[model samples]
Structures are given as C-alpha cells and as structure tokens.
Target chain A: MSQANEFWVVAEYKDGELQEVTLEMLGEARKLADKAGSLVGAVLMGEGVAALADPLAHYGADRVLLLDDALLAQYTTDAYTTALAELIQEQAPSLVLIGATANGKDLAPRLAARLRAGLATNCMTIKLGEGGALQMTRLDYGAQFQRTMVCSSTGTQLATIQPGVIGVGKPDTTRQAELTTVEVKLDPNKIRTKALGYLKPDPEKIDLTEADIIVSGGRGAGGPDRWPAIEELAAALGAAVGGSRVAMDLGLIPWKRMIGISGKSVAPKLYVAAGISGASHHTGGIRGAKLVIAINNDPAAPIFQSADLKVVADLREVLPATAKRLRDMAVSDEQGGQQ
Target chain B: MRIVVCAKHVLDTSIPFEIDEESKGLVEDGLVYILNPADRCAVEEAVRLKERQGSGEVIVMTLGPAPAQEVLRECLTLGADRALHLLDRAFDDSDAYSTGFALAHAIEPLECDLIFCGSQSLDEGCSQVGAVIAESLDLPQVSAVTQLELGATQGSVSLQRKLDRGGREVIECSLPAVLTIEAGINEPRYPSLPMFMEALHKEIQVVDLDALGVRSQEVGRRGALTKHIGLGPIRPRTKITYTPESDIDPIEALRLMMSGQTAPSGQQSGDILKGEPDYLAQQIIRFLQQNGMTPEANV
Candidate 1:
C-alpha cells in the first residue's frame, strides 16, 4: 500500500510567521514516520518563506519542499491548489497532513479532489491503526458523538487536523533537513478568486481554536462587572478567555471570543466554564477539550454532564480563590527555584 | 436564472442518543431529524438572492433516505421552486468522496449557473462536497462564504468569506462557481400560512442512483474511499430531569432528589460540592493539582 513511503505536512505560513499547527503536524508526522518507517516531508509555500525550513526541520521534517514565489504570496484558491496538487502528484506521498485552519480547510479538499485522493477534515487524532491503516478520529454531528475514519483509498490519504488538538514538540535546533526548491508555475489569469483584502481581529486577541487553555465566561456569571474575574483566572492559568453565545450577545465579551455551534470550535488542553449552564450549542464547541471544569451555582447545570470536574457554587467565590492559589504557588515555586 | 442549493438531512443532536455497538452508528430509535444548520443558511441565501434579482428559480437538492424529503418540503415553503431528492439505499453509508461523486453526476445534466452548499455538514462536518462537486464539474468554488454580491460585469461576484477567530476575507469569483455558505449570514425567513399550505401540494422530483447513471458499487460501502471503522468514547449525556410517578411516595421521592441520589446516571459522577466557599475552593485546587495542572505548568 505504500507508494512513495513518505508522510507530508503542508506548512501553513501566514502573517510572516509559521503557524503553530505546522509545528504540531511536523511533530506528529515525525512520531508516525518513526513508528511506521517513512520519511517526513514538509511543504512551505510563500514568498521568502524559505527561512521556515530551518524550524520545520528542527521540529521534525526530514525534507522541506519549498515553493517560494510572489504569485504564491497572497492565497488564491487556484494558485495554491495548482502548485500543491502538482507537487503531491510528483511525489505521490502516502499521507498528506494539513492544518484545519481557515485557508488550509479551503485548500485541502480542493487539492484532494484534483489529485483524486481521500481527505478527512477537522480530525482530532491521526495514527496508524490495524494493518497499518491511516486511522483518523473526529467529532460528528453537532459534536454529539466521536466517529473514527480510515482512508480506504488507493490514492494518497489527506487529512486536516483541528488547530491545538496536538501540541508542538521540543525543537532540536541542531537538526538540518534536506531542502528541495520546487519551481511554482501558476497563471494569474486562470486564478478564479482574487483576494481583495482581509479583516482580522485585534492582535492582542488569541484564536480560541489555537489556544491551549481557555477560561470561558457565561451569562450565569452575572454581567460585565463579573467578566474581570473570569479574565483574572484565565491570566493566572495562562489561558485565553472565551465567551458563551449568550454572554457574547450581551456584550460581556467580544465576538471573536465566542465559542459554540455557530462560532469556532476550540480544542484546548484545559477549559474552565465559569458560571456557564452549558447549553448544547456551547458544549458542542468545547467537546474537544482534554479536561473541563464547570463552576456554576446550579447543580443541575447541563454543562456539568460534559465536565470532568464540577463545582456547584457561586463562581464569584470559587474563581477568586482558585486564581489566588495558583498565583501563590507560582510565586513560591519561583522563589524556591532561585534559591 | 437558476441556482442550485444543496442541503443535508441530519439528526437533531439536541436530543439524547446512544451508539449501537454492532453497527458503530447511532441508535435510530425514536430519533428526529432536521436540516443541517449551515445548509439551511444556503437555502435561505438562495431564496434571498433570487428575491433580490426579481426573477430566477431555486432548486434545492439533498442525498439522503426517503424521510429526508421532509427537508426538501421545508425548503419549498421557504421559496424554493423545486426539490430534487436523490433517494436510494445504495447510497447509504457513503463517505464524503463517494457522496460528492454521486452528487456531481446527478448535477451535471441540470447545468445550473450557480451552486450553493453549506460550508460544512453537521453530520460529518466534512467541508468537501461542494469543492468535490466543483472539481468534478470543472467549476470554480468559494467556500466559507458569508456574503455575496453580483459584480458590475457579468460572470463575477464580490463575496466575503469567514476566517478563523471572527476574521473575514473579501474575495472575487467568476460565475458558474460553487459557493459554500457559512452560518449566521442571514436570519432565514419563516413561511407565511398561505405559502406553507401551498408548499404541501408541490411534487418533489425523486431520482435513484440508477437514473443518474451512478452505479451502486461506485457509492455507499462498496465504493467509499473511507470507512467508519470504530466509535470513540461517548460522553454519557443523560438528562438530569427526574419525573416522579404517581405511585412513588412523595416524601421518599423528595428525599431521593435532595440527597443527591436522583438519577444516579450509572456510577458516573463528577465532584459536586455543597460546602463553604473556602472549602470548595480547596477542593478545586486539589483537583487541578491532581490533574498535573499545577501553577508551575502555567507557562
């Protein structure tokens, strides 16, 4: 079943930085290839993004296939797909991994269709299953259940993993990867979509899907006056702040922090739901979190069902105590370490 | 002008469910279904586009079981001119790739100018069907679309696509393109009483896999490039509501409810605290510490 005996990670380079998911994919690819016996390849596409090859190798790419050109700088569906499809066909790698980010989601399916490959999207986990099959698991149907999928195709297997599902590995800066520069050929006239511009949230905000830890405020947490307590806990825990739909609608938090069925689905290491009743829509987004603790006054809160730890009390009291304890521990640890 | 809106029939996941061990699928007993949320937005967008243009037809389509026709009927009441139901058991358990393959073949003969689909389906959450259809038909596609406006010149459009973290990107695409709509683009209109009654009389065009020249083996389990090999751990989601019967002693039931014994949920229980705030806070810290989430790990 192995055609080229290589696992590829399509590097996502945006805003002049290598996206964190790329490093995660590289790390996961390294682990997979080490166990399965294959070379790990990374594809970096952007003008002057060749510098990213060093970090890709340090994280785990054995070979970096660089596609650097001005035409490939701004992402147009046609330009990126044509360049990537051609490379994958040339290499015929057994597996292709991509980040389930905004542009990556738009690009992977189109590339898979062009290459006649099978693709799994929003995958939470990818590993070699029985008979060395490429097994993938993802949330299904409003996050009601978890369904495992495997590529039964004879063609290349492709998957886009959700951001933050896997953390990055320690970089071995001593490593160096074999770099192969691929000549990009794309006709501007054939590009169907023109990227006019972009609208990004404030730079101070963290993307919920990419955040490793999050503390989300709910309507049950009272009004805007109580939002700061949630933020303080998030700051202590080094987590991003999220807002339930009702809280966002009430203007307790910004729209970008919204998490639920309609907003971004987040996969954090730990999630703290402060005073949230755990509506189905909100729970749908947080299902991917590794650990969840729901603090609310209502014992019958629906959020408790999904939570690993439940505290049925006023968050106004619980949050302050938790944050203070965490901070105290950090300060004591720092003093002890300095001695 | 003709616009094709593709919708999916999915389980009403708000309802509690249990997975069947044998089939590795959901238990179908006493289940209700609804249109995929994003796809409903696609339907609504199609109607709104036609309404703005003043003349055109909205052809809504879906590939599902016979009961899925309910969604199509629902679409008709929302201003869809016709419904195309691709009905056949041969198409069951089809993966995203084969599902798109069958839909592409069925759509080829229609030769519509524009195609609309949900950015992703609620069932599989695969955002690939529209792109696959576009690739099969050699048409351009714009996905995660929030807003679309016709261009000054024909054969072009100005659209805004959704990005991560509430970001949006403006883009331009040519006509005859497949557009996958995002949710929250618009509030779907509710049908008037007159329109609801009129939609009941409209006949849906039901076509089987054979009619579209699609072989049974090319789809479903036979041709699916992917297989749902296993089920992952299901978070036990038993509702907490306890309704007492008339036979039960009222005092006993009340005691059962208050003693934290109502609906034990089969041995699965999280830590429920009912103590002083300071004591509860200590419990929270201990739990976090046991989980290896110490303050030192907060870097």
Candidate 2:
C-alpha cells in the first residue's frame, strides 16, 4: 500500500449533467486510488450540485464534497478558485486531477499559484509511481514530442488531463458513497469580470470531442462546397465532421472545428480523412484515433502512412458511393435482425 | 500607456530535430532558431496597439540565452520601441512555473499598463507561464484571445476568446490585465528593409537573475514544480496491410479495403489497387456482399 491516503478528482457539471471528462477522471482516479490505498474524493462546486454526488459515486468516488451556492451558478474565476483552493487546503489530498476544459484550465493555474503546488497541464496519461509520486505524460512542442513529468514530493501534485483521451469506467448502480456539503463565503468584489453571456455556434452540429467517429476534410477537398461529400459520409457513419487548418483558414469550416496542434485535440474511435495531405500538423490531432481510413487521390500523401485503411480515389465519387454502401449495410442488418 | 509583449526564440520546427545524447534535449549545434510563430502574433498585436495609440511605447521582453536576442531584435524591427532580455544560466533548467515566477519579478518594477503573451511556446506548448505570471502579479488573465478590443479611455478591455469545441466567449476585464494571444488574430506586418536596417543598431537591456531580484535557487531545476523524467519520439500507429488491386475481384478487394482490421501478419503496408474506377467500385461492392453487408446479401 502507498503512503498517501487521499486522491481527489474535480467534478465539472454543465448543461444540467456531469461533463464526460469528470466521469473519465473519476475512472482513472479510482485506479490510482486503489494503487495508493487512498480514498477517491470528488470535489463538486456549483449551485444545486449536491445531487451530482450519486453519479460521481457510481463512477467510483468514495466521497463527495459539494460546495453548492447561488453565487457559483456560473463559473467566475474568483469564486470557484477561492472555494476550491480552500477545500484543497483543508483536505490536503496528495494529488488532484482536473479536466483540461476551458474553465478547468483557468482554474487549475490560479489554484496552483495560490496554493504553490506543482501542476502538470494537458497530461494524456497519468500513473502513481513509487513513493506515491504522480507520474504524468504530456505532449509538448506542438505534439512533436511527449514528455513524462514527475511531481515534486513537497506539495500536492495537480494535473489537468485533456478531455476524450482517457476512457470512462462503466457505471455501477450499487456503489455508495458519503456526500458532505461545505459552505463557502465568496467575496463578490474579487470577481473582476462578469460573464455577460455566451455565444454558441450551430447547435445541430455534433461536438468533435463528444463524437466517436470523425470525418475530416482538408484543402484537397477543393473549396468545401459546404463539404457535402464529407457530410454525407459523416451522416452515414454517425460521425462528427471536421476540417484541417487550411480548410478552416479558407473559411470553408469554423475554426473551432479544426483538428491540429493549435485547435482541439480529439481521439475518436474511427477517423476518416478525405482530401488531406496528412501534414504533421493535421496528423498530430488524429494521433489518438483507434483507426484511421484515408481517402485521397495522392498516393504519396503522408496521411496514408498512419492510416490502417487507405482508399486512393477521388472523394467526390468515392464518398457518395461509400455512404450508399454503409446505408445499405445498415438496412441489411435491420432485415437480418427481423428474420 | 506601455504594453509589454513576451516573446520566445524557439528552434525552427519544420526542420527535423536531433536529440542531444548527452543532455537528452534538442541539439543546439547547427540548428536554426526563429521567433516562435505565436509569439510573432503577440508582437504584432502589441505593435498594432502601439500604432493605434500613436504615443505609447511597446516593449518586447523575453527570457533566454544570448542567442535569444535575435527574437528581441526581430521585435524591434517589427516596430517595438525597446527590448528587455532576462538572461541567466540558472534558468537553463527552469520549468514554466519558475520561469513565470522570474518573469513576474522582472516585470513588476517596469512601468506597464498591459501585457501580452503568445498562448503557448511552440517548443514546449506548456501554456503555464503567462497564467502563472498573472497569478503572481495579482492580475486577471484571458488566454487564447483571438479578438481584442481595448477601451483605452475606460480602463477596460473586451475580447473574444476561442474555445476548442466550436464557440467563443466574450469577456471584458479591466486594464492592467494579461492577455495571451492566439494565432490568426491579425496578419503580422512584415518589417520593411529600411525598418530592419534602422533597428539593427538598437540596444537591448540585459538583466541576470540577480539583477532582476530573483534568487538563483528560485529558478532552474531546484525551483521547478515538475521535472522532465523522459523525452522521446511519439509512438507511431500500428502497421497496416496493403492489398494489391490486381489479385482479386474488385468488389472483394474494396470490401477488404474498407475494413479497418489488421491484415494478415507480415504485411507492413496495405493493398494498393491500380485498376479502372468502374472495376474498383465493383470490387468494393463484391467485398460488401461477401461480408453480408449489402441488401442483396440478405437474398
């Protein structure tokens, strides 16, 4: 058994449910906690968040500390950090794991600075090494190299893990955990910026991070044309649609849907590359995909090197045909089920 | 108003990198260095802000070895009014946290109203320094800022921050805040020949760890929160099996092509079919039929 007795995972809730990354963190945290002989604690902060303790427990949390208040209905840096840092100081867990979301990124650094703790950001893999030290692997230099970091022994080890990189454990309905409410006093004066509101993109489109499969187009797709061919394949496969930097730069796709070092890093179950040359920049984003299938006219495209399946054909013709085949396959599966 | 922009000189990434056997880091000898791409955007934003004000100075500040002076020089040529280099051997092993601590100390005494930094360094992509510095200096920070609007007269700045999942957040913060600029915010103007020549002779003020009032113990490996335990190439994807286009029926060939499963062992590359388009399409259909995936397969 390890010397540390506590492991903490910060829970993030949005749109009235626990974010996917929170569950993933709990899943990984449970393993590390078992290794260290430590109890896994979930720190949930937000208004009306006490009810989230059950889901966290189902994901393997042994205890839940909820800091629910009206002031925290929306995330403001000062309030959340103050409450969280205070709880961390009190609990003094050996390690804290946070999801590398926008709010999580902003909060982790501020909390680390306030607590003077060592922080590893954007870690893809984490393990508890000998002597209870947290070992973390993260991508650096624009995904050119992976660096493994070991936290110092002096203070609490903190890390922000990227979303979609880690797998979530199956929920256990019979799991039980203790929930405690902690009161926090937030000074409204400390909040320098008020979240006036939020602006969203087209809601009909699936989020890249949440999608299991992705169909990405590049400059080779020849000017987007609303990316109908790519969309057809995505619709057929039930995958999200994405684009490369060139396609995004040309205003053919939204910049937020870009897959590369600078944009969102996604790890889908299956990735379809259409008309992309597979430059290191674009390929790096697809590194975590379980399987890659490339469709490009250029046989020399670098993307072919990384793909498990290659179709060297013009996407305009191949995409429509492929989509039809997949649709037909689905129909046959239904018919077989009926028989 | 004085705007301070943080710049970094990084090894050019387009060229292949060779690791130094002795240090386990990039080999410095014979390697080309350039201003980090995103830092160039930060400099551009600072220069644009200076030009808009028409009276303020934009100072470029950086922390690195002597070779990094080239980055500061480039900023000068690009229209910065002055340069500051925090140079010290002790910082060679510093991580993002310690570096930010030293930088915050260095900038605390300077007269500044706003600070800008590239959201990340291309060499490390840690993205911790700017936020850490902001925390140390007790200032609000907004990162990944793509659109910036400065209300100079109102002592506030409103900006649009990019999100990874497809949206933007509009945030407004008071002046004297830190903003980490992302790429593509503005097209960086190229330095003209005359401007380049004029900036060649400008002096960059150099300060060491002691001069900046930062103790040597507070930097380098000793002060670092995290230590690099290992560095190596990223693991490549699993090998693929290639099927030759001429060996089988086109439909059968295409079915095997669409399947993402690994091919028989010992096949390093996948099949390459060089055939007529009509034939290839038929092969795909045949493969689908063999797999019982087509409606006809049910018959």
Native-to-model Cα distance after best TM-score fit, residue A185 in candidate 1, in Å:
2.0
Calculate each model's fnat, 2 decimals.
0.63, 0.42
Instruction: State the lDDT of candidate 2 residue by residue for A46-90, as single tens digits.
Output: 887777889999999999988888888887777787898898887
C-alpha RMSD values across all candidates: 11.6, 9.6
Error of 2 at B172 (Å): 0.8
lDDT by residue (B1-299, candidate 1, tens digit) is 68999888888878887888888877889888998889888989999889999999999888888999999999999889998898889988877777778888888888788999999876678899888888889888898998989977797888999876667899989988999999878889889999899899887999897797977888777867777888756443222232223235778667656755442222125357777877887887887787667657533
TM-score of chain B of each: 0.77, 0.78
Model 2, A109: alpha-carbon shift in Å? Answer: 2.0
The clash numbers for all candidates, in the given order, read 0, 12
Query: Lowest-scoring 10 consecutive residues by lDDT in candidate 1 chain A?
Result: A199-208
